[model samples]
Target: MSRFAEVLGRLAATIEARKGADASTSYTAQLLAEPARAAKKLGEEAVETVIAAAQGDKAGVASESADLIYHWLVALAACGVSLDEVAAKLEAREGTSGLAEKAARKT
Candidate 1:
């Protein structure tokens, strides 16, 4: 696996481990305790990422995108979905045209 993928996998495991942690001490646990809150955080991070991208700030975009992905992963965990499952879906889409994938999803 690529180093990036390895980092994400490790982060996922760390997040998963925090599911049962004390909310007062663990931000991940707090997020997991209220999935809606986690979703909201993901949305906020996405906006920041978009703003960074629109402003042509490479560093800002990179940082905000990392934040976005982190929040998104937390949201997924809050929803009881694993990163492996997400990876599987992505893998299943490999080689398919983006338009074809969209069309297939609509059915």
Candidate 2:
């Protein structure tokens, strides 16, 4: 596996393991326990990442992107969605024009 995949796999595994943990001790558990809260956090992180990128703060962008990914994974986990499900969606988009894909969504 690529390093990126390995890292994400490990992070996803850790989040899964934390699902049954005490929320007071594990932030991941807290996020997993509250899907709405996890979704809100994901939104917040996404905005931060966008702001960092807009400001041309490379380091800030990287840091905020990591936060964004973590919160996104947590939100997906909380909603009982798996990485494979997300991957399938991406795979389906392969070779499709972005504009065409988006236009199809509107129908």
Q: Output the TM-score of candidate 2.
A: 0.97
Error of 1 at 21 (Å): 0.5
Error of 2 at 74 (Å): 0.4
Worst 10 residues of 2 by lDDT: 11-20
Top-lDDT structure, candidate number? 2
lDDT of every predicted structure (CA atoms): 0.93, 0.96
lDDT by residue for model 1 over 1-107, one digit each (tens)? 99888988888889999988999999989999999999999999999999999999999999998898888989999999987798899999999999999999999
Range of the 10 consecutive residues with the lowest summed lDDT in candidate 1: 4-13
lDDT of 1 at 102: 99
Output the TM-score of candidate 1: 0.93
Model 2: pairs clashing at backbone N, Cα or C within 3 Å: none
